[model samples]
Target: MHTRALVLFSGGQDSTTCLADALTRFERVETIGFDYGQRHHVELAQRGVVLREWRARFPAWAARLGDDHVLDVGVLGRVSETSLTRDMAFRMEAGGLPNTFVPGRNLLFLTLAAALAYRRGLTVLVTGVCETDYSGYPDCRDDTMKALQVALSLGMDQRLLIDTPLMWLDKAATWQLAHDLGQRADPAGGGDALVQLIVEHTHTCYAGDRTQRHAWGYGCGACPACDLRAAGWARWRGERGAG
Candidate 1:
């Protein structure tokens, strides 16, 4: 069993969920975030808030929580003109991908994450990349993750297992996963606490609009990130109500 893990956390709902999952699965779990000069840099700020909430509310996971590292990869934003990194309006490109799809963004993140994991003696690398309910970013696909896993292991000469707990799960299921994880950590009120932490503190905004409030979370409520999160939350809550 891989004892230690490093999650590629972005302080978004997805990554935040992955972090919670990691804290439960691994004996020790660390987090790594990237500052790619994206338009929604606010997520970086929100990362701390999520961590603090979890530490204060969930003692079980807090005991397992390790260090958090944020790397400044501003070069990615400098080179890419995508809507996520720039102030431009969002649109679909003729090549059949969203303008927010930053080429090689996930790849670079995993590469850097693997390097950090190697130095830190972490064997498992967890990411929130999901093709199920995400933009049509090729890098978010399962194949890309598998290939990167092999490549990272071969390149680093270490057994680095890439874990994608959200690969097959939709946004609602992702939310449910967090709920379940929280319950395991703190059975009394952990489920609601974790879900509340995500809805109130985490971010999934493409435009980084924290002013607007929504049931799902904080976002512009218009970007693809917010749309997925909102729709997922509605579906999950709707089903929850029906059940």
Candidate 2:
């Protein structure tokens, strides 16, 4: 029932899709991005570009978008030795978690987001966390988020709705959702506006390479993030063909 939402956006495919979905469902949407000294911090720049493009493409919806916020949690990088925040090589942990997993990253993000939302009088928090086609990050799990939501509510003493539109969706299904959102936002009343915005403006590469452009987007194709995105794109294409 909340009309306003704050999204934890990363300027990646999943988060970007979540943002578009938020625009359609909420009267007001704001985004918060973090600068935790991650190697792929270039996505922060892409976040600005994506917001600007969305504003230009759909003025009505864009008007509803609140200012994008970037928090400097770089201290996390100093304290955490994860591949995402440090120069260490990426690998899997003994229990099967990726080395890129920054302990309590999502927890801190959601707590910060909830604080912001409370101050802004927003009642909903949307995130792009997906269990279907994502690294084995325990924080991305629905149960974890739900537990955090309850904890946040108890701590803040206010009701906050946490929405995860892509929780049950695979990467290909996510791509399709983005496409569907684009069609809904198209000024012509039917086109790929959302998908186009995602491909041209968003950044998902963990390597933070802006020079290497592909059919999917800019990325160092060899990185795990890029590989996952490419695989999703391929599956999406195949599904389209089959349909």
Candidate 3:
């Protein structure tokens, strides 16, 4: 039997790279996305489109892959004090992190994914939490993921392997990986395949504008997301030129 993995997908760059990695490693992979009243719900819809494209591209992939599940868990936004959850006028604090840090967001998402996996008899849970190439989101670190994995296993009496393929790779490397995975590269596009997907399909904008496009993705260019994206663009473009 092919190893089954449940991906905590957000359709963002990191998660999409992780999803592509899961597709390569796991013979059977299904995605679980959340509509947690985020500033960017359009990204969730894009995730659906991406999945549809995947299914169409690989017709048998859906049978091997589980159906995409979208749950409206808006309680996180109601309870969390972070700006990402609440309608707080947050100013981005430099050298620390972005205002959109939704505390316990990944924890809650992973916990829910683990619960679903446990119920479905699946043992592998994959996520796209990158410690590098991201803000100071504490939950995106490996330590938190490990703790959550242990907690899930002990709580459910089932071993869950939480895979983080992008945890170690930087943003440029992530794009390179996506390019290596046969994702279409836009020649006129300065960024790699992952970056292009992130810009075109995903939404990292905290203010929630889907129509906007930067060198990175759809976000206010002044936000932390845009900063990281700009830095990544420079790095990838430089590397591409040098190569």
Best model number under lDDT? 1
Q: Candidate 3 on 70-177: residue-level lDDT in tens?
A: 878998877766666667776766647677888788898988998888777678999888888788789999999899889988998867888888898887787777
What are the per-residue Cα lDDT tens digits for candidate 1 across 84-132? Answer: 9989998999998999999999999999999999999999999999889
Arranged by lDDT, best first: 1, 2, 3
Cα lDDT over the full model 3: 0.74
How does residue 14 of candidate 1 score in lDDT? 90
Candidate 2 per-residue lDDT over residues 1-243, each given as its tens digit: 689999999988899999889998999999999999989988998888888888888877777888888898988888898888877666888988888889999999999999999999998999999898999889999999899999999999999988999999988898899888777876584337777788888888877888998988889887778888989988998989942
Worst 10 residues of 2 by lDDT: 185-194
**Which model, 1 or 3, shows the larger TM-score?**
1
Give model 1's clash tally: 0
TM-score of 3: 0.85
